[model samples]
Target: MNRELQPLLDEWAREAGVPGASVGILHDGEESLLTTGVSSVDTGQAVEPGTLFMIGSTSKTFTAAAVLALVEDGVLDLDEPVAKYLPELRLADPVARDTITTRHLLTHSAGFLGDVDIASGWGSDALAAAAARFDELPQVFGVGEVFSYSNSGFLLAGRVAEVVSGLGYEDLVRERLLEPLDMTDSWFLPWDVLTRPHAVGHVLRDGKSEVAHDIGLTRSLNPGGGLWSTAADQLRWARFLLTGQAKDAPPLSDATRALWRTPQRAAACPIEQIALGWMVTRHGDAEIVRHGGNVSNLQLSDFITVPAENFAVTVLTNGVGGGVLGPKVVDWCLENLAGLPALEAKPVVPTDPAEYAGSFPTGDLGFEFTVRDGGLWARMVATDGTIETPPAFEVAFVAEDVVARAADTRRPLARFLRDEHGEVSAVEFGLRTAQRERSRLTA
Candidate 1:
């Protein structure tokens, strides 16, 4: 580990309003741990490498692993219609029941809105309540035609795991995934764990740190982003993700492992491509599998693995800023510690005043890109004509070719493809969903 980077990371924790931050790096098959700040501002305890923090959506890798395990046993089929397993499942659109398949669910192509709260409640009943509400959501688009990051889809997928494995969601993960990987300190607990010796979440209120509220327990979306873990345990999980095997771990087949990292669909994200539960990218010559998580004010986490490089990073924060804070730490470590290049800056071209004007529909998400001050700016308008600017990266030229850049990270815009006539022909935002170009509706 680079000793010089430690103080820099602490500076970031303070700037981001995170109470505590921890990072683990695996390089050349060796591991190093680093931590800074206090775990809880209330208790004044220094953050330790072993402190457990909520890992948010990074937990999806575990859920995806369990689903793949059932696939290996023929207990589940990735391509089968989800309705086959949960006969009671339905969407506001009756056709969606038949059209949405397990594959669609895994890839976020089912068109289900990400409305269900994962941080609602804890325990089996909370999971049941989330599962029972499948019929209420409208299909945002035809199944598999567009990608809308859907937490409900994963929640349903988790239900599928329970139905087939005959184990509760948490237990299935604990026994099948966590236990084998020896992630002994990791587990799903009630939201009150936020009040324990665990790190405290924080939000910057009026430029000062204020303890953030635990945004309730995730009852329905637990499968999507609800697990608390330490930097050490996350390192263990990251190692498994890198090697697809752990010592004394009941081994998964190479095929199953490969399936987990395969890109399923382009997510409706700004930066990386989305696989089933993982994000896939190339950091220089290395194949990187990664994911990040956030749950309002409570917790944030990120996990990244470079399989070919034999390197991995796990970051957890006690407060809300931990979400991006963790990734920043990872980016710093990769560039400084692992000798990876800092993310290359994309070329920025001044938009031609005339060419910069147009209204385009990105499936259900629509925005108008306009020329302003010799630069291109975009404003997303809702059906109600309310205008909002999504993170700047949400606006891009040529759809999929656009990239969104943040202070700590960069995400690619969903790409739009055009036909020879210069008419839009297809649209792909994330790796998961692509819609063919169709005739513009005449009003």
Candidate 2:
């Protein structure tokens, strides 16, 4: 481990305003860990490499790999509709029900709402039930039309795995992925985490970094973002991904592993596109594949892999404020360590007289876009009421349909799409998408 990086890690944690955080870096298959801060304010126990952090949506990578493993075994078909495996599968739109396939789900083009607004502990049968209840949720886009991040899609994918393997989602992953990788300490349940040294999620309550009420994701969604792991285990996972090889690589073939890293959908933003479980993008000439996981107020984790340089970096923190720690560390590693130029955003270039006015609905959040200064401006509102929108910012054009609010560049990038009439139809705001609700603000 590069001990010299400790100070910077400590600084990043403090900036993120967390009790403690951990970072894992892997370059050329070598690993280093820099852990700082406390696991809990109540205990004041220093964070350790063994302490588990809930990795949130990064678990999608695990789930994706498991399904790919079945694909390799001739038990699953990537092109076939998920209903083929899970006979109970249904969605709100019958077209989506018939057209959406495993490929669409993996690529985030299945048209299912990103999330079903279902809480975590709906019981052991929760994911299966959630899959059956998709018909109750809205379909934001046509099948394969846009990339909308879908937690529900991954869960349904897990269900397909369950049907093919006759094993629970967590067990299938544990038996197939974890045991092979020799990750002894990682687990999908909070009960298992409690048996080991683990960190509770910290939240910013009234501008204070305090322990969060919920330490783990709802029990059923474990396949989506429920795994709790240490920095060391994450490094092991990164190393496996970096090499795309394992001792017994039956489940995920080399070709499928490469497919997991390859972009499956075209991007409307500055990024290249969304791969199965990774975000495939470019930083200068070097390709970067990464994913960030957030349990909203509880925890935020990030994993980045730069395959060209054989480099990977992961940041896991216990609170919302510390979300920036992962990418910042990534920028540092690539620039100073690898002699690579990290991606820097071009200055905000305001779009010309775009009619993004009025509101659009996503599963959870809605956006009210207005014409200001002859340019497009957007104020986002959370339907779940978890966040409050600040003053509107000018939506900057980084590409034809891709736009980003200058302040929050981490994504859920606004992608403006056009109809056959060549007019802006709807803008995809993150995973939750909405069409225009009105031309002018509701008076």
Candidate 3:
């Protein structure tokens, strides 16, 4: 299997301009790990089997899983208002503060601005301190009104875990999830990772891959996306998700595992549904539960699995554009390794592409869509000076009111949302609903 995957990994890493990457696969009751390229452009270090790469939001699954374990232990209830656990917790909106549930947090439907990142401190009170600052985060939509990805929500969930268990979030996860799965190489702190072989993140600037900022994630965000793990450890995690058994770790009951993959709310196109901690989708005849993570344009990671087939694949890359390599590799693995054929989209030229043209703002970044060359194109605009904006890229309607980048239709970029009058009012991009600014601009 490595013979078949190594060449593809090498070729795809080069094509994606990623410095280094590691691929892990669980196939037909066996496992395979393949790696390619240097860990960093400057250091020229080879990526080894145990080299750790930050898993980013993929850590959310473990956070959600830990919350679910607490639920099963009768320590907490999923539907209970989060205010029950953290009575002092406050949001910018009063109602949301009182009514948001742990379930809402797991499904990312808690509905405030989901992108808030606060570095409270390296102390044990980090999670709680960071969450306390959430009063400044304005509510973008009503509680559970729609599916918007919330890193903030997970931090709250982690804090709840900390409070209820009387253990720190990292300790709770290590005891409840990671240790059981035998993911011993995965670490959440920078100090822990720095002592081991780890991959440094890289970013592409002016067509050259350069080493990115190496300071690890803030302690407060660990529950959301701060995991540093190896490909083998990630594959072990995938195996546990696939079969829910670890020789040394207590198993999460079958019922709880099923609930984790159960659809909690409807998401936009490409993503069919949002489960407790997993994104559910159907590609061809297989149901795929997966998640992808990016750390501020530094590292990229993807984890995908087909439960019915007991097949899983994880791709960990060390560069910004490296994420593109994941879908390509997954497509190949599904076809050749898992025997599932690819599903191609047959998109059409919309009659009035102008209807989708407008400026849609979400937090610090926004997108300006325009009609050009008989199609819709979008340029990412920075709403705040902190954001790095990208050039305009063409997109196509893969489904009604949904657009994906023209180059990769399988990855939906934004889904248009209509108000009561049946006109486009906003867009759900990156899982956050961005209200549209009216305009008749054409490029």
Q: State every prediction's TM-score relative to the real structure.
A: 0.82, 0.88, 0.95
RMSD of each: 5.2, 3.2, 1.9
Whole-model lDDT, candidate 1?
Answer: 0.69
Candidate that would win on lDDT:
3
Per-residue lDDT, model 2, residue 311, is 85
Candidate 2 clashing pairs?
A: 56-225, 69-251, 91-135, 92-135, 120-218, 359-437, 361-434
- lDDT per residue, candidate 1, 1-443, as tens digits? 64876887889887877878888778888888888888777678898876777787787888888998888888998888888888887578888888778778777778866534533355576766677777767666788877666667888899989998899998899888888888887867654455445776666556566665554335566788778788888888877777765756554677788878888765654545578788787777766888877655466777888776778888877775674577678888788767788876455433243333455543334545455544455444332322222333224343233434322124455454556987555444333233342333211
Least accurate 10 contiguous residues by lDDT in model 1: 385-394
TM-score of 1: 0.82
**lDDT tens per residue, model 3, 379-439:** 8665764333445788988778878888877666788889999999988776667788877
Instruction: Indicate the TM-score of model 2.
Output: 0.88
- Poorest 10 consecutive residues by lDDT, candidate 2: 385-394
